[model samples]
Target chain A: MTASMQSSVGNPADEKLGMNLTLRIWRQKDPSVKGKMVTYKVTDISPDMSFLEMLDVLNEQLIMQGDDPVAFDHDCREGICGMCGLMINGQAHGPQQTTTCQLHMRSFKDGDSIDIEPWRASPFPVIKDLAVDRRAFDRIIQAGGYISVPTGTAPEAHATPVPKADADAAFDAATCIGCGACVAACPNASSMLFTAAKVTHLGLLPQGQPERDDRVVNMVAQQDREGFGGCTNIGECSAACPKGISMETISRLNHDLLGALRAGARPKS
Target chain B: MKKAVMAVSGIVMVLYLIAHMIGNLKVYTGRDSFNHYSEWIRTIGAPALPEQTALTIIRVVLLAAVVAHFWAAVSLWRQARRARPERYVTKKAVAQSYASRTMRWGGVIVLLFIVYHILDLTMGVVNPEGHDASPYDRLVASFSNPFITAFYVISLLLLGMHLRHGIWSATQTLGQSNRRRERTVNAFAIVFSTILIAGFLIVPFSVLFGLVD
Candidate 1:
């Protein structure tokens, strides 16, 4: 087993191999409370521990010291869940392309001091610390991010006859985990990449065609209504995306929107 | 739809800049050629259409494009501001260029310069020297003033920066960019903007230095 596993169980033997690090975490009692970065020094942290696990140790220390632990969000410890997100060192999802849970302590040196904060967009207000309301994304999706069909049929998967290219592109677009990292990393806090990912994913498939026109128009309108900034195509969204969703999806979204406009289709209010 | 309008109008402006640059270079060909070219612009549709008819048509189309472009820009700027009401306490800008970062300010400077340009040259209201002279003489008189020359140089530089970002962004907005072609598109934007700026600047500099007099 790794040193992290041993240290988790309170084994003294692996203590010598751990590293000391400092964390500057944001702390806010609630949305109305003024937040500040509270620094804490963590000793004997295992290099193999995930970033969240390191936070867990810090929380334990804070609890033992009769202090309020820093609040954060996490569900699946794995990267796919999209529940965990942090602006580690001013980057969305830390310095790595992976999510917070997947970021290991080894990415940092023993003497490193890390800064952690929540997503800072207006649409996403911080609830406490490191957790913002990303429901604006949900609202955008609900606007028209899905394909509509009659329920209750397990159709044969091969019947659709999707081209390999389109299937692959759709899958790539579908990889968006609804994380707000794209918004957090963007200078304008634009959610075009995230919105485009949803639009392109469904727009690429045969099942997505019927709703395609309305889908782009409605979803884009919803995105704007949510107060997410217009995309300048600066390309930070793709860079900050944990799944590496391409900016091409945004281009595709624009293409679809133009086509919809040319066809005289207006988004449903 | 706003982005589409911005991209289309922006491209139209870029094309106009290129054609205008090429036309201005004729100043080096002597007063007869330069004045002839300037007169030709107004007489393009003569006989079939009235004098200055073609130029009026061009001006109207360009005015409509400029209005659309400016409106879209302002709306997008306001929308972006609303997107993030609370700014980040500590922020890091990744994957953004200096040109991209300064686009708004650069656009403002370019807009101001366009107004100054129209006043000084087209209307002859702001020209330091004689306003009743021929087109070629007015061009010479304006650039001979150091302050006017400096203003033109500064404005052209800002315009070049704006174009550098504008061209690449227009392509992306129009869905012309991809992973492989991104670098090519960026390089093309740089080269194209540089050449356009240089072509335009040469006229004012030549007049300032007495090369074209």
Candidate 2:
């Protein structure tokens, strides 16, 4: 058996190596309630605990004391779901590329006082503490992101023989998990990153060719309609992206949008 | 004529700067060459269109371009504004470079400075107080003012930034999107803006520092 396993098996004292920590969490009854950071002290935190798991431990203690449990959103715990998001010390998703769930306590030191709060943006209204309604992203996607692929027909994956380069680019775009980190990380709360990813995803594929022009047109229009900011090509979105989505996608998005504008001007000649 | 209008105007502005730089290069040849060069251009109307009508037409065309460039910029800005109502806010300056972030403000300041420039030099209106001399002498005296020299420096810096974006953007606007050409244009934009800023600043500073006198 390994040393840790063997120690736990051999002596009970070995299991007592835990850290004491404090958390200042945002406590809001609802979106309407003015929230404040309420401090909670916890002892005996497992060094191996994921940050979310640590929160779970504190919530378990609160419930036993008949106090209202702190509410936060999380799922998948693998960083793929993108459900977990929080600003730990002013960073989107708290000092990590992906999400809150994947962040472990070990990334922090013992006795560290962590400040956790919800993503602050006007459009992303807080549903409950730490869980803003990200449906603006859904609406952006619904506005014409998909190819008009007919239902109930699974094509042979290899039938189209997509050029390797285009396919890879499309796959890179497809990795966007609809996390609002880009929007949160942006100074202007710009949705350019998310919208561009969706547009580029469709724009890169041959199957997406039929409605490519229309897709760029409507999606860009929708993104603007949804109150996102114009991209100044500052490159913050790509830098904060967990998947490292390139700012080149935004460049491509700009080209496509500009092309769409030209097409609008040209008429059915 | 819309695309051609922008293209022709943009190229004219670019060529004017090149010719302006060559004229300004006369500073290296001392006050005599510099003033004589200015006098020669005014007399012979170098780079201006056919004969005496050339100077008048050049002025008209230059003014038209100023209007067109500003009009296009305003229209595009309005469209972009209507497109996204919310602005960005950040505790830190994010991934944006200083030049990229300051474009709008820089453009506006330079625009205001251009007005001052026209009034001072072109129209001979709103002349600075206590600086009466020949146009050339006025130019020298104005450059002698630390305040005037400072404004010239600051505005020229902003002008450099504005041109860095404007030159590259105008190229993209013209649909020269080839990768090689885009990179070339981008580099050219940087060099062109830098040279223009340097050329313009040198004259004022030279006169200020007694090099011209």
Candidate 3:
């Protein structure tokens, strides 16, 4: 078994010790309340602990001390569910290309001080400390993010002969977990990278061809209506993406959009 | 759709800049050549299209392009502002360029410069000499003044910066960018804008410093 796959708890024979660190965390009572950075120190933190686990320790401490715990979003601590996201040290997903949940405490030294904050886009209003509403992404997806497959027996696995290149590209585009780190990292708060990832993933497949024209058109319209900034292609979104969704997907999105328009898919006026 | 409008209109303006810069270079060839070239633009299509018809058509198209460009720019700016209604309390710029950051203000400066430029050169009303002079004489007279020459230089520099970011952005908007070609695209933006700016600047600087009289 890999070292990481081994259980993280109760390995006392290992000489690895705990670290003491300072955290500057954003705190707010709720969406209506103003938020600010509140500092708290955590001691005796195991290097084996994931970043969220360390946060869990801090929350435990806060509860024992009769103080409000710093609020953050997380579901699966393994990083696949895309629920947990944080801007650690001014970087989306904390000093790594992976999600916040996968980041290990060992990445930091004992004396390190980390600054944590919530995603700061207008569409994503703060719900509480370190948790902003990401339903804008959901709205974008609902607009045209899926293909229509009839309810029936499953088609033969090889019935559709997709080119290997296109299948690979589609899979690459599908890795996007809808975490909103791209929006958080963008200087303009643009969601082009996320929208494009969704657009390209389905658009590349034969199953997605019937809705191609309408999908790009409707998805982009929803994107604009959500108050996401126009993409100027500074490319910070792709850079901050934990899944490494490429900027080329945005280019593909543009190509598809233009094709749709030229093909008489009138965007909602 | 807004981005596509910005990209297409921006390309039209870039094409106009290229043609204008080449026309400005004709002044270095002497008075007859410069004046003849200016006259030639008006006489284009001649009897087939009537007097100044070609020039009129060009002017109308250019004006339309400029309007569309400005409208798209303002619309995009509004959307960007609304996207982040509340600014980050602590922000760090990661992948943006200086030129990209300064685009809005640079555009304002360029707009102001265009107004002064038309008044000074196209209309001759703000020329240092009287408005009745020949086109060549007006060109010389305008550049002869140190203050006028300095303003021209400063505006052109800002124009170059605007073009540096604008061209790269337009390319991305038009779907011409990819990972493999990104560096090439950036280099082309820098080199192309530099050459265009230098081409335009050569005229006034040459006249001011007596390289052309």
Which candidate tops DockQ? Answer: 1
Q: List the residue pairs that clash in candidate 1.
A: none
Sort the predicted structures by DockQ, highest score first. Answer: 1, 3, 2
Question: What is the DockQ for all candidates, taken in turn?
Answer: 0.58, 0.20, 0.52
Tell me the tens digit of each residue's lDDT in model 2 across B1-213.
133344456677767767766676676776566667656655574455444455576688778887776665565456445533333222334466566667667867877998987677655565553334445655766777888789879998987887776666455444444334656876888998898889888888888788885
TM-score of candidate 3 chain B vs. the reference? 0.96
* Tens-digit lDDT string for candidate 1 (A92-176): 9888888999999988888788999999888898998777888999999999998889889899998889999989999999999
Cα lDDT tens digits for candidate 1, B1-213: 788899999999988888999999999889999999989999997788899998898789899988999998899898878877776666777788888888888888899999999888887888766568788988999998889999999999989988898998898888777666888989999999999999999999998888987
* For model 2 chain A, the run of ten residues with the poorest summed lDDT: A260-269
Alpha-carbon local distance difference test for all models: 0.88, 0.71, 0.88
Can you give the lDDT of residue A15 in candidate 2?
A: 72
Alpha-carbon error at B132 in model 3, in Å? 2.7
Report clashes for each candidate as comma-separated counts. Answer: 0, 2, 0
lDDT by residue for model 2 (A22-136), tens:
8888887897777788899988887677889999999999999999998888889898987878777666776666677877776776687888877666657778766778888
* Model 1 bad stretches (over 4 Å): A1-18, A150-154
Ordered by TM-score, highest first, the candidates read: 1, 3, 2
Q: Which ten residues in a row have the lowest lDDT in candidate 3 chain B?
A: B86-95
- Give the CAPRI class of candidate 1: medium
* Best candidate (score: TM-score): 1
